[model samples]
Target: TSIPSLPGISTMESLREAMPYFELILDSGCSQRARQFLCTLLEPECQPLGSSVTPPCRNTCKVVAEECSDFIINILDLSQIFKCDNYPDSEDECINLARGDQCFSKETSCGDGSCIPKRWKCNGVLDCKNGIDEVNCTTCNKYQYACESKDSCIPLEWRCDGNADCEDGSDEINCHQEEEMVMHSHASPCPAGELRCVDGRCITLQQICDGNKDCSDGADEANCRIQYKS
Candidate 1:
């Protein structure tokens, strides 16, 4: 069962006043009171701004279901592509779109004889049944492709060779390359006095110079002079 919404009287003037105070405090490095107030606001089981029935909120300040969704969608479109009014809503129109002159191209020879419109280009999955939607994604090979397999795929590479191929190189996944572990020229398998290599990579020496001896050949203090004062 849905919980009943609480209501309250919140004039635009009250929201305006509250907004300014909160914004000013946020702008200033927070004080203890401010932090406590923010903590309460961020608490999971907090109540709405008013009791009984909540006051209406604006787009950015909205608590309304549809307005809130549209507001968030608007904000999201600033950085990411969102399907908009320009998209064809009719299924027939979308299906026939490929046959129209608007989808023509002589330069690209796609698998299904046609390609996705240049405007729609990231290839996560195919939009067309023939998989012609991913025309530009067929180049990966040599560097260990995931699927640069058959002659039918454009760039003639990613066609199913039991392996994938692409050179930003993401097709053949998790083929980890082994890096050769280099031993320092001064390294004696057993070291003394925290004496390890420091060519800038921060590899700490395995041995320590506590006194007497540690690294087989007193390599820790071999050439040092000791002075004692009473």
Candidate 2:
């Protein structure tokens, strides 16, 4: 043992002095050769958790080195235990586990049956009272909506100007996808939606001067009533 021995020191208090150097020996946790020398040097025990007569503590690990020699031995590779996802953490029935129940002023429960995150998903009649909760609910139809009042599963807002904002076609009805028009005075095609994705890449005169085509169809540099030098 390279550790300097103490003469009459007893209890965990004495063992603390030599631990820093001993820890340096196992600092390379991957080395088995180092471990062998450490085991011989420290002499730990492989005692059962509760079977130990001496209390286990930080300092006690060094003091009880011989008696608990096997305990300190990293003898084998052990896989960590993993619990199943669906398994309840504890078997105790005394716990009062409320999932997402919030405390309101009055004891009024939103009668959407299951307490899903969104109140609109609960049922047809605005369980959340405010229609905005259901206004932006997910919908599939382009012109139709999943209107709360109608409470129909299918869409109802289908007059496509370009937007499918609401089931009732009440929000922005005549919205178009806004395609860019091509120009003749200048060069380059200004396509509509294509220009949105790009920034001032290379646009043409017909796309811009004609107010149509700096973009995909000349929509990008379109509609510049006043023409400037290239």
Candidate 3:
């Protein structure tokens, strides 16, 4: 059945804004069937804006409801798809579905109502089903590189520093290749107080044999010949 065009429920944004009122109605002794219908209408469906089925209208509630009905019908028809009942039996059930998962202190809700860690919001990958998690993300800090995961931003200086700072390992992928090029090029000596390793990389002389392998080939700690002259 088609829903009537309701006042002040035109655009998707307006529908989202009206959700609280819908919830209030449900709580204020609305009929169980009415509440179930409203909850079904509220379920998220991928709707394209400006489609022929969703022409620009001052009140698109009827169209939206029709689309929602079709969406639920299609889901029910899918044999392999498993979802909660087509219509929530209670307001609490509807709310629980709307609040897909518990968010941590440093997390945010996606457009589809799922929660993701805040760090996964804008590193690069689209964690939100609607790609909303990456929208309006804060710009990376100066000299910071964005990871392919779209959830992390690492300092530019940290890239190729013999460490994997980006979760996708993008920061260190070509490090060895660059080092190989430097090795083949002119024999530029390391600056004062810095020692050159076998791989032509440079480290501070102080880093030698202090319980760490600074050199890639372990040359810094190859042999122990400490002499005690008392």
Candidate 4:
């Protein structure tokens, strides 16, 4: 005889109550794909409890039914697993997971229940507490370079600039090698008494300690220390 469908998972509370049964299914030698699908359904329960949201739970159930249909056919019924009287019926009642904070006209929700501006997503900064906003981003903005870990984004001009702008130091790695490769090909060099900046520009020594920046790379004003002679 076929097993009866498990209780509805339309709410976090119900989902939590159903976990042990799911775990039983997992331990009973379910296929790897079925196990992963079950884990996705259980993810929200793993999060800290907050104001209950139905859309994400419902969406997850939909994915399980569509993607794991064959695997779940005899083991569980999708209709009973997804049924929840409390599920939102009206569009207005469902909160948008992608909605931004009040300050931002557009926002996206993080896995941790925090909201951030849509523009901040995949911009390289970990605005979300769990860094979920920047995860799985395949591309970056124009003139922006993706970090070596691909977890963040930086400006293209920041690459190979002798500064560790990326969290992983990818922006400065191999910078000297690149400079050595192009040094002989470039005609730019400092004049006799001027210091050469990282960007190959020349500036007077006096400009180095005058509380002003003369080089595009700002190398002239960095690491200035006063010297004394007895």
Per-residue alpha-carbon lDDT of candidate 4 for residues 130-221, written as tens digits (9 for 90 to 100): 78966788675655665644567777677767788977675665444234324532366555434566666665433443446677765554
Candidate 2, 194: how far from true, in Å?
A: 22
> What is the per-residue lDDT of model 1 for residues 167-205, given as tens digits with 9 covering 90 to 100?
323233222210011233244532221223223222212
Q: What C-alpha lDDT values do all the predictions have?
A: 0.29, 0.31, 0.46, 0.48
Q: In lDDT terms, how accurate is model 3? A: 0.46
Best by lDDT: 4
Clashing pairs in 3: 122-150, 123-150, 123-151, 124-149, 124-150, 125-149
Candidates sorted by lDDT, best first: 4, 3, 2, 1
- What digit string (tens of lDDT, one per residue) describes model 3 on residues 24-133? 54465422233433544444334587531211211112212322322322321221111323323343333332234454343467866555444456646675668897
TM-score, prediction 3: 0.25
Q: Best-fitting candidate, measured by TM-score? A: 3
Candidate 2 global CA lDDT score: 0.31
TM-score of each: 0.20, 0.17, 0.25, 0.23
What C-alpha lDDT, on a 0 to 100 scale, does residue 117 get in candidate 3?
46
- Give the better candidate number (2 or 4) by lDDT: 4
